[model samples]
Target: MLDAALKQQLQTYLERVVQPIEIVASLDDSAKAREMQELLQEIAPLTSKITLTERRDDNERKPSFAITRPGTDISVRFAGIPLGHEFTSLVLALLQVGGHPIKLDAPVIEQIRNLDGAFEFEVFMSLSCHNCPEVVQALNTMSIINPRIKITSIDGGVFKDEAEARQVLAVPMLFMNGEYFSQGRASVEEILAKLDTAGGARKAEELSTKEPFDVLIVGGGPAGAAAAIYAARKGIRTGVVSDRFGGQVLDTLAIENFVSMKETEGPRFAIALEEHVKHYEVDIMNTQRGAKLVPGKLIEVHTESGAVLKSKSVILATGARWREINVPGEKEYRNHGVAYCPHCDGPLFKGKRVAVVGGGNSGVEAAIDLAGIVKHVTLIEYAGELRADAILQKKLYSLPNVKVITSAQTTEVHGDGKIVNGLSYKDRSSGDTHKLELEGVFVQIGLVPNTEWLKGAVDLSRYGEIEVDVRGQTSVPGVFAAGDVTTVPFKQIVIAVGEGAKASLSAFDYLVRSSVEEKELAPTTAAA
Candidate 1:
C-alpha cells in the first residue's frame, strides 16, 4: 500500500512516538481488507512501540481499524483504506495516538476537555477531497483530548451503500450522535463555536478589549497576508482579523500559473502563507469576520460578535466566493446534490451522471475532471461556444463520457426533496427547454466578490466590487481595498499580493501626512 520512499518517511515520522500504540483491525475476506491487513502489518514493525491485532465482527464495518493507546479509552477508527488526500489524516491519527504533541491552542484543548457531553463524530469523506483532512484531524484531536469524543472516519467510496442510504452527496458530511452536524469545510474554531453557545459572547468580549491597531487588515487571503507582513515590517501595530485565514484560496485545487513555483496545491500554499505571516509581529485574529466598517479618526471595524475593533488604517482584502446560478432548487439541494467545487466533491459521484454548468475554463475543467470519475458528464454552456482555451476544449471533447451543450441556459434544479435527480435548461437559439437527468450539479459560473457588507460604507462598482485608486485606497481615507474584493482588473494571487503591499505602503504614507497635519493644526488652535 506504501512505496519504499514513503515507508522510509513513515519510519522517520514514527520515531517521534513517545508512547506505545495499538492497531486493532476488524476485517472480512475482501481485497481492501487484505490491503488494510498488509498496511497494518507493515506499519507495526517500523517501531517497537506499535502493535497490530485483528478480529472479525459482522456488525462492524469491514476493512476498518482502530488506533488506541494501551491504557486509555481513546478510539480513533478508520472504516476504509484512508489514502490519497486522507493519507496525512491517517499519519496524524497515528502520531496523535502514539503520544505525539498536537498542534492546537491550549485554550481550545481545555475547552474540549471541559465539554459536558459525549460526541460521536461519524465523518463521511472521500480520498480525493482536499478539504476532508482538516475536519478529520480536528475531530480526531478533539476525541484525543476528551475520551468522551469518539471519531470514525468513513470513506464514502468504500461505503457507498450507507452514504446513499443517508442521502449524503457531499464529502466531509459530519454527523454527531446520529444527527446531521454539518457539511463541507468546517474549522475547529467554527465547530467549537457551534457546540458552545457562549463561545461567541466570550470571544467578542475578548476582541473588544484589545487596543487599537496601526494597520488592521480584513480578510486573510493573499492580499491580507501580504499587507499584514508589509505593515508589521514598518514597526507598526499590525493585526489581521478574518473568519478564515486561507480565504477563497483554500477552495482552489491547482495552481500552475503562480510564478517561481511550477506547481502547488491551495491548502499547502495557504499554510505556507500563514506560517510566513506568523514569522512577523502581526497579531492574527482568526475565525472572526469584519461585519461593518465605521470610518472616523480611528476607523472602527465591527464584527459579527458585536466587537468593535478600532484601527488607524483598514485594508479590505475580503476575497470572492463561487458564483451561484440563482435558479430554483439550487439552494434547497445544496450539499444534498448541488456542489460548488468539483475537485472536492467529484469523487462522491463516481459512476454516476453529473452536469457541469458554465462555459469558461473552470466549467470546462470541471467537466473534464468529472469525466474521469463519473459515469458521464454533460457540460452546459449559456453562450454559443465554450470559452475555455483551445487545448482544454480539445481535451474535453476527446473524452468519451463527456457531452457539451452550447447556448443552453440553466433554469431550475430538480430534486426529489432529498437529492438532485435532474435539471431544466433552455436552448438559446431554438427557445426549447430540456432536462438532463443526473445525480449532481456542479455550479462553475464564476465568482462574486465578498463585499455585501461594504455597501453604502464605501464606493462600490456596479458589480459590488470595492472601488479603489491605484494606491489601493478606497473613497474613504485610510481605508484601502485589494484582491478580488476591489476594482482590480485581474484577480490573480500575484496581483493580490502586489496590491496588498501597495496598500500598506500607501497607508503608511497617509499616516505620516495625517500626523504632520495634526501637528500643524495644534499650533493654529493654540494661537486662536
Candidate 2:
C-alpha cells in the first residue's frame, strides 16, 4: 500500500533510528486487520532496523499496535490503523522509540518532565483528519520524555461505539485523564498548558495575568499573528490569546492560494505562521479562549482562564468556522457519518457514496476532491447554479463519478442510530422532496464568524461578523477586526494578512494622535 515516493520518504526518515524497534500488531480476524497487516508488512521491509510482529486476538475490539524498543519496557500503543495523516504519527512514534531526541525547547521539555502524576491521553481521530496527527505526535513525544504519560490514538471509524459514547463530534478530540481536554489541532505547548491547569499547577493562569499590553490580539490565526508582529515592531508591548493558533486553517488539507507558496498543508503552514510571530517580541498566550471584550480608553479582554488582559488597543481575529446545515440528525451524526471537512474525513468514506451540500467554491472543491477518494459524489446546491469559479466548475464537471444538482435545499440529515445512511432534500424548482442514499454527507455551505464574544462590544454585521472599515477599524475606537471574523470582502490568507497590517498601523496612528492630544491638554506652568 506504500507508494514509491512515500516509501522513499519513510525510509529516509527511519534512517535516524539508532536502535531496533518492534511493532507488535494485535489483530482480529477482520478485514481491517488484514489491511493493517498488509500495511505493516509493506512498511517492515523498507527498513532493516524496524520489525513487525502480528498476534491474533479475537477479543480485541479493534486492531492495535504496540511499539517498543530493546532494553525499554515502555510500550507506546496506537488503538487504530494509522493511515492517511496518522501515518506520520506511526513514523514519528517509531523514531522516538528508536531513541531519537525529542525536538522541543528546553523550557518545554522541563515542563513535560515536571508533570506530576500519571496522565492518560486518548485522542479520538479519523485517518483522513489532517490536523489529528500533530496532536497525536506531540502526545507521543511527551510520553517518550515523561514515562508517566500514556497516549493512545483511537481511530473514530473503527471504535465507533467508543466515539459515540463520548459524543465525539469532531476529529482530534483529546481526553486527558478521562476528561474532555480539547478538540482540533493543538500545539505541544498548548497541551502542556492544559495539563498544568488540570493538575492545578496554576502556572499558565498565573503567567497570563502578569502584565498589560499596548495591543492585545485575540485569535492567533493569520490575521491575529500578523497584527501582533506589526504591533510588536513598534517596540510596544503586544500580546495574543488563542485557543488554538491555526484556527480554521488547521482543518484545511492543502492551500494553494496563500500567495507565493505554490502549495502547503494546513499543519505545515500553521507552524510557519507561529514561527514568524515568535521571531518578534509578541507575547503569545496559546490555548486561551477569549471570553469577553470590554472596550474603553483601555480595552479589557477576558479569557476563559479568568485572566484579564488590559490593552490600549484590541484586534479581533477570531476566524470563522464551518457553518452547520442545522437539519435533523446533523448534530447527532456529526462524526458518525456527517462531516464538514472533506480533507479531514474523506478517507473514512472510501469506496462509499457521499453527498456534498452547498454549491459554493468550498462545496464544489470538496466534491472535486472527494470524487477521487469515494465511489460516487452528489453535489447539492441551493442556488440555481454553482457559485464556484469557472475553472473549478469545469474541473468538477470533468469528474465522471460526480453528479451535480442545483436549486436543491438540504431538508434533513437522515441516519441510522449510529451512523448516517442517507439524507433528504427539497428541489426548489419543482418543490419535490428527494432522498439520496449516501453513507456520508459533507456540508460546505459557508463559514460563520467567531464573533459571539464581541456582542454589544463592537459593531457586528447581521451574520455576526465584526463590521470594519477599509482600514480594518471597527466602529469603536481602539478596537479593530480582521480575517474572516471581520467585514472583509474576501476571506483569504493573503487578504487577512494585509488587513491585519492595516489594523495595526491604524491602531498605532490612533495612539500617536491620542498621546499628542493628552500632552497638549496638560496644565501649563507660568514662568516666574
Candidate 3:
C-alpha cells in the first residue's frame, strides 16, 4: 500500500522538476500496476504520460523508462531491486536521462571498468558508523562507472534476522555472490582486489576457515593489540581484527614517551606489538571489524563481511577522534596546512610558521613539538594562562621560537584554497583584532571520545569519558573500558596502552570467577 505522505512527496517532485518520464511496474496484479502508474503521474506530471503495461511473459519482464527530450538522452532498465551500490544505478539512470556524465576520479573509474563479470554485492550498514558513508559512496561510484556490478544495501536494524543469518557483524561488507568478500570501509583499489579474489576463491575453503580467538580484537591501536596479547598469553584463545593492520598508531609520527620506549613512532610501536602478539599464535583478522556481537556463553563476533568469531567476551579498543577546528576553511585545508595531531602532521610544516590552538597540556606540548620543526610556533590560548603543568610551561617558555599568546582566540581561518596562508584572531583583553600569516595550523584541542554508541550502555563522566575504576572496571559487569574514552587524567598514548592492559587483565579475572561460580551451582540444579 502506498502511504499518503509518499504520494504527496511524489506530487511535489513532479511539480518541481517539470520533466516527464515513463514508468512501468512488473507486478502480476493489475490493480497494483495501475496504482503505481497513477502515483508517478501525480508526482511527475510534465513527463510523458504514465501507462500500465501487462507482462506477457514473466521471464521477459523488464521495467523500462525512455526519456526523449531536447538536449536529454535517457534510458533506464531494471531487472532487480536497486540497493547497495544500486543507489548509484538509480543516479546514473537519472544522469543518462538528463544527458550529463557524472565526473569521477580517473583511478576510481578505472577500477570499476576492470571488474570481470556480473558480481552480486550485499552490504549491511549502520548509519552510526563514521566510515560507512565512505563505503556507500565508493560503491555507488563504482556502479555509475560500470553496470556489471549488482548491489544491495540492508539497514542493520530493519533487517536484523537476515543480517544475523548472513553473519553480518560490521558494516560496509561486500558479499560477492553468496561468499563474503571484504568488510569495513575499503578503498577503491582494495575493493577491486577483493572482488578479483572473491571470484577465484574456492567455496569450500571459504566456509572451512577457522578463527583463533576466544576474544577477537578489531583494532591494533594500544587497546586492541594489547588486549589480544594479554588474553592469549593468559591461555585464553584470542585474535586481533584490524583494518589498517597497524591501526591509528601508523599515523603517529613521534612518541617521545610511551613509558618503556623513550622515543617511538606510532607505526614502529604498533609493528612491535603485532609481532609480540603474533608469537603466541593469536590469529590476526587483518582488515576486519567486529561486525556482530551475538550474546551467549560463547559469544559470536562477526567481521566486516566475513565469518562469525566465537568468543567468551569482547572489548572495544576503538578510540576517540581528534577534535577539529570548526573555523571556516579549516576542513578545506586539513592536510595542506591545518592538522589535528602534532605527532602525525607536525613535521610537514618544518621550517615554516605555525600556530597551535587550545591551552591544555596537549596544546602546550604540540606547540613545543612544532617549535623544534617549524621556524616559528605561535601558541594561541583562549584562557588567561596556560593549563599545562608548570614544568611543561617553563620548557615551552625556554623555546626561543615559541611565542605564547594568552587571551587570544582564533576567529577565522584564511586559506588560498590550496594551503592555509594566514589567520585572524581576537585579543580578549584589549578587544583588538590582528592577522598573522602562517604556513600551518595545528589544532591541539582535546579529542572527543567515540562513545556516541554507548547511549546508556555505561556510566560516563561529565566530560563524556567512561567512568572506570583504577582496575578498569566500568559500571557494567561484562563490559569494561580503557584508553582515551575513560576518565583518565593524562591523555597520553602510553597511559592509554597501560590502561588497556589493566582493563583486559581485570576482565579476564572476572571471567574466570564467573565460570567457577556457574560450575559450583550446576550440581544443585541437577539435584533439583
Candidate 4:
C-alpha cells in the first residue's frame, strides 16, 4: 500500500508529464503479480495524464510493465516489481517517457548517439540493491536518446533461472548484447568505456613517463581520496588509480555515522567525494584496477589493463569486501533471497521472515535492525555464545520478533528455484540437523581484505590485512596503508579519513627526510 506522503511525492513528480503515458501491465495469478497490480493502481489515479491497462496473461513468466507514449512505437519494458531503491528508476522512466529530456554531459550524449550497431542491455537487479537504480537509469536515458540502444530491467528474484544461467552472483549485473558487461555499481563513464572497448572503437591515450609522482593512491575510497587531497595540498604531483571512484561506499545505503552530516545516502556521498577530489590537482585514473604492486626506489603499480604507473611513495587504501558463506544454493540465490548488506537490502524483505548468519556485532546489529522491518528474524551463531558486545546483545535480545540460536552451523541454503525459502543447519553440540523456513538470509560473518595483490610487495598480517603501525607506515619504507585494508582497529568511514590524513603526512615526512639526505650526501661545490 502507498503511504500518503509518498503518494503526494509521486503526484508532484508526475507534473512534468507533457502527454498521456500508458503503462501496459501483464499479470499472472501470483502474489507478487497482485502486489504489482495494486501498486500501479494506487499510483495511477494521482496523475491525470497517466493511464494503466492490465491484462491477464498466464504466459507471462513474471509481472511485466511496458511503457509507451502517444506517438512512440517502441515500448520500454520492465520485467519485475520495482520497489525500495528501484522505485526511483520507475519514476525516472515515466518522466523520460513523458517527454522530460534526460540531462547528461554533451560528450557522453554524443558517444551514445554515435554508438554503432544495435545494443540491447538486460540489467538483472534486485529491488533492494542500492546500486542498481543508477545502472538502470543510465541505460534508460541512453535508450531514450539513441534508438539503437534498448533497455530491459529484469528482477533477479522473479527470474532466478535466467540469473543463475548468466552466473549473476551480484546485483546490477549488466548484459550488453547478450554478453556480460559488468557487475555491482558502475558509473556511466565506466560503462561507456567498457562499451567502447567491447565495440573495438576505443581510442588509446598516451601516458606520460616523465618524473614519477610524489605519491600515488591506489584506491578511490574515502581513505585514498583523503590521502590524495592531503598530498595535493602540499603542491606535489599526486596520482590516483581506481577501478571505480567510490569503491565500496557506492554499495552502501545510508551513511549516518559520517561526521558533520546528519544523514546522507551512498550515491550522493560518493559524488561529493569525487567532486572534492576534483578540486585538487591530482591526476585521477578511473577504471584502472591494480593487478600487482612492485616496490622499489620508485613504486610501480601494474594495472589490470597492462599499464604501469610509477610513484615515489604509495598508499594502499583498497578496502575490505564481505566474506561469502560457502554453502549450497548460496551462489544461486545471491540477489534472490541471499544478501550481504542489511542497510541496503533490508527494506525489500519487509513483513517477510529472514535469517542472519553470525552472532558477532555485525550480525547482532543486523538482527536488531531487520526486526524493526521484517515480520521475524532468526539469528544463528556457530559459536556457543554471542560474540557481540554486551550492549548490542542486550538490544538484540530485547526485540520480541528476534530468535537467536547458538552453536548452529549452517550447511545448505534452500530455495524453490526462484527465491530462497529456507536453510538447513546442524547443531554443533548434538550433531543433529535442523531446518528453518525463511524468505531471506543475511550473511554478516566478517570481511576479507582486498590486499591479495600486495602479498609479496608488503608485509601482511596473519589475516591478510596490510600491516601498518600507529603512523600508518607499513613494514616497507615509503609505503603506507589505511582504511579497511590496514590493521586499524575500527573500520568506520571517519576513522579511515583520519588514518588517511596520518598516512599522507607520514609520506610527506619521508619525502622531506629523503631530500635532506640527498642534499647532505651531495659533493660540496667549491666556492668559485
Give model 3's TM-score versus the native structure. 0.55
Model 4: per-residue Cα lDDT at residue 207: 32
Candidate 2 lDDT trough over 10 residues, lowest sum: 199-208
Alpha carbon deviation, residue 121, candidate 1 (Å) = 0.6
Q: Assess each prediction's global lDDT (C-alpha) against the native.
A: 0.91, 0.85, 0.62, 0.84
lDDT by residue (370-454, candidate 1, tens digit) is: 9999999999999999999999999999999999999999999999889999999999999999989999999999889998888
lDDT tens digits by residue: candidate 4, 482-507:
89999888788889888988999999
Q: What is the TM-score of each candidate against the true structure?
A: 0.98, 0.85, 0.55, 0.78
Better of 1 and 4 by TM-score: 1
Ranking by TM-score: 1, 2, 4, 3
- Compared with the true structure, model 1 gives a TM-score of 0.98
Model 4 TM-score?
Answer: 0.78
Q: Candidate 3 residues 1-528, lDDT tens each? A: 336775554444334333344444454444434443453444343333333343535642333222222333232334333333333444444443333444655744665687777776666554333334445545545654665665555455444456546655345456778887776556454576466665223321342266434565546678776777788879887766565554555545567877776897564576687778778867765545445455466655555555566656666666766777688878776655676666534544557798898878889888887788789998999889999989899999999998889999788878876668888899999999999899788887777875654656568787778788888776766556677777888777778778778877987887888889899878654555
Return the clash pairs for model 2, or none.
Answer: none
By lDDT rank, best first, the candidates go 1, 2, 4, 3
Question: Can you list the residue pairs that collide in candidate 4?
Answer: none
- In model 3, the runs with Cα more than 4 Å from the true position are 1-213, 245-248, 289-310, 341-352, 360-362, 372-375, 389-395, 398-401, 430-433, 521-528
Candidate 2 vs candidate 4: the TM-score winner is 2
